[model samples]
Target chain A: MPMRTVRFLFFLLSIAAGIGLGLVYGWLIKTPDPGQLTPQVLRADFKADYVLMVAQVYQRDQNLAQAVQRLSRLDPASPARTVAQALLTARDLQYDPADLQVMSDLSRALQSLETPAATGEPAP
Target chain B: MNDNESRGNLYLFTGLILGLAVGLLISLVISPVEFVDIDPSAMGEAYRNEYRLLIAQAFQSDGNLQRARERLALLREADPARSLAMQAQQLVGEGASPADARALALLAAALTNPQGIAFTPQPSPTLPPGEEAQTTREVGQAIFTPTPPLPTRTPVPTFTPRPTATPMRALDAPFVLESRQDVCDGSLPAGRLVIEVFDRDGNPMAGVPVQVVWGQNQTSLFYTGLAPEISPGYADFQMEAGVVYTLRVGAVSDTLNDLSVPACGGGVRVVFREGR
Candidate 1:
């Protein structure tokens, strides 16, 4: 029994194996891509970006029902409020008011939306 | 256990610990999480442009340097002047159409030194060709003269009194904040803050008196809709951005200092499962 003695060597070899395993795991889990910004990473610009997305969606889709659904995810006070803020932000940013006419249309469309009370407010 | 068996167990434990430590070290160097170095020059390109434009517009409206500097600082630009110059050049280099020529010109105006003259974007097309050329010439003068020359004046001009202008007063604002969905001093304009009160049965309560107050005893009182639709347990009050208000409803009271962003997108919400 005194034989299997080199306990340190056994421990060292196992440690080495663990290190190799860790490297393998690291390679498998890819990191973020360069120049690639996800919605979560771009949290600071999300508010402004949200408005732009809404504008694009509103323009291409041109449907009030779907626009409201998409906008509701933004957690705005209301869809109309988001539109109003977008208009003001656009104005403040000096974007052409004419280009934001759709925002005004979206604003009107949101008025007919069944109020938050009907659907229940989204979770904070 | 035998000595050999006991020794093997110890070795295994040691190996596991060492392996984990080595692997962590290797991973740290060989495969770290990706992180791109962010700089103001590269990050939020659209947002930066828009913000710079806002600064220019605000400067136009107020002609206030201290305020302008404070706002531009938000862009994280150490040298806003340099940043503005590059943006102007970028705009012009983009081969902007004649319609966009003014915006390019505005960038130049923002970059101009000795900003004493007022700048109004979208120059009048009615300006005669020669006059417009002359105006451009003045801005061109600024592009080269990094260190602007001091204004030359023979003497203090005689003061001519101009008529004083009246200031626009904000309407008295009042709203209840005890319930959910109440906000104060929000940075954006939402519409009027509408709070709908409900009863124990989850039905909208009408004719509930709500009081809103701000600044030294000024108060406005209104009852939630007398009828379901009118008050429908719902009441709205006009609120100005950047002001704080206190609300009192049936002994439920709280403070709201959120700036309005548009109706209540998501500033305040008081949960009322057991609606009082």
Candidate 2:
């Protein structure tokens, strides 16, 4: 190949190598703190525990609005769905039966909230 | 040709450096590493508070100290009890539900001196028919015991009662005023309502909630043992000189009225001993 063509190819190769190094540094060497991260990235077990907590509090307070408010932090679009997901994870993890029962209570509560009849409003 | 080769090498080096900068910006700012399936240890400060609150509430619901301890370990705090206690104090100041603050404080107290406290049975959700309540698990209780202020301090209270499975409020231990001393010293701050709490045995208790009410039902709630340097079970409030205040320790304690700061530019000290 001509010297100019060869030089251009070398430049491209160098650029690719630089990009790879930069990616490694950013993604691995200097990652953000786990404690400083959002809940969306939480492990399945932690998410399940969080849901159980909401359930436990809901059971005590019996306030659907407050329960929904707390769950909305985990999944804004559908807090009920988040509870359901947590129930599944809790079951898979073989959590204590009492804990599972509380989660189920919350899931049922959230499901009731999503229903139109429970809210005294017509379905959309 | 030699000069041309040197120029070509310089161009390649420039391209590499330029590409590296672009990649770093894209990775660090534009498209940073996205976290997935992370544990509680990696949660942000606010979420960590939420997590701590959840642990305390769960403990309240199930009365599971060991489980709560295990969950709290995920946070990797150097002193989990201290963190819970501080959070409890903050929640009380923020006007959170008394139950929430009490739960955190209960857990902190449980962790601090497990042997000295007893927990009352908290009501649980009704179980399904035929699914007997799990009675095998060892339940946790909620009363906090005071630690002595110093090695040479007064004799610690004797821990006697360990009530079983009785349903009671978190802070049901009734305390009565043991003594009230008015100090009119030039050294102390003006209008300070200094209070100390002890068990029936004269042991100084930590994490006792103190309530002060004044001026048409205006109230301020605070906890003791926050400032360990002075003494555990020691908490003070700044009182307006003219306003008369009522002081109560815990839920069932007898309210003490006419507790105003003495006019001598000093503080008043009140000692409470558990009546039961």
Candidate 3:
């Protein structure tokens, strides 16, 4: 082959290799775990406003039972849980049949959550 | 390699490195990752202030003057808006009696928006002189003071006690007892019956059975209970002139058989009328 032609071929091959390497490096560096981007397991740190909006809608519709149920379904550890629980308590105060046992149960549930969890292994 | 080809290759390589460096520098400047530790104490203090304000508002709405005052006092101690706290304190100090103080405080608290507090309503402490004293005393004496009166015949014909008249009127029934005065966060006038039913936690109890009694006859009125379809909270009942009434509130349960009300526990008497 002519010397110029040979040099041209070599340059083309080098450019192709460089382009291929760049493509592979970009793919490897850019990939992210699918699980991390899922909607279900996303941390609910900033969901208070949405939760409160739903609760208020339930309340406005005078569906205290449904409001309470929806509120209870939320993760207890969520910051929104406090506001949800407060609204539920308010509903109970206004309308729930005054079952002392229910009140007692709620008190117990609040206390249990408020206390720190034990870390020691279970007894044999 | 020839000189011309070498120069072209060098330019391409230099351009690629310069472009890559520029891109990286732009990314670093525009969207740098940052780590910050939130000040929990400052956040907590802010939350506490908000909670205090909310409690004050609820109390004010319910005509609980004393409670409003107490909450505002706590808020003041916490160094929340100094001017607003001082204003609340001034209003509370003007209350004449303990009951007046409580009613005014609660009313003041209720006036604030619920969103402002972002907290649950705490149980209100029972106010002293809750309508009980007004019934037992002679019709005229009950209006003025707590003391029992000396039997004396005034020239003005003494108001005859009616044995058959219903003691309390229901909101939905024929005699719709509208709040004549803006009793919102204010004193409950003498001879007025304000019945508030509460559960064991002191939370307002809804839909309990309430009875108004006078002399020998008693009338039963179910508190328009709070259902999923209904508004939650107490069914407000007010008193009218010349008629004495007693309230009997039932327990918060389906079995209504467990009706336990303090006003009727020993039998309370309320005389309803406009002005003494």
Please list the residue runs of candidate 3 whose C-alpha ends up more than 4 Å from where it truly belongs after superposition.
Answer: A1-124, B1-276
Winning candidate number (DockQ): 2
Interface RMSD of 1: 13.5
Instruction: Output the worst ten-in-a-row residue range by lDDT, candidate 1 chain B.
Output: B135-144
Give one digit per residue, the lDDT tens place, for model 2 in B145-197.
Answer: 12212212111111111112233234477888999988786555788888988
**Is candidate 1 or 3 superior in lDDT?**
1
Worst 10 residues of 3 chain B by lDDT: B157-166
Provide i-RMS per model in Å. 13.5, 9.8, 20.4
Better of 1 and 2 by TM-score: 2
Docking class of 1: incorrect
- Whole-model lDDT values for every prediction: 0.45, 0.71, 0.34
Residue range B198-255, candidate 1, lDDT tens digits: 5555544433445668778877665443222232455566666556666665334444
Worst ten-residue run, lDDT, model 1 chain A?
A37-46
Which ranges in model 1 have alpha carbons more than 4 Å from their true place? Answer: A1-124, B1-68, B97-101, B104-108, B111-276
Highest TM-score against the true fold, candidate = 2
Residue-level lDDT tens digits of model 3 in B111-168 = 3322122123444333356421111111111111112333343221111111121111
Question: What DockQ results for candidate 1?
Answer: 0.14
Per-residue lDDT of A27-119 in model 1, one digit per residue for the tens?
Answer: 445434433422222222223334544554455446566666556544434777766765665555444343356456666667666454454
Q: lDDT, candidate 2, residue B145?
A: 17
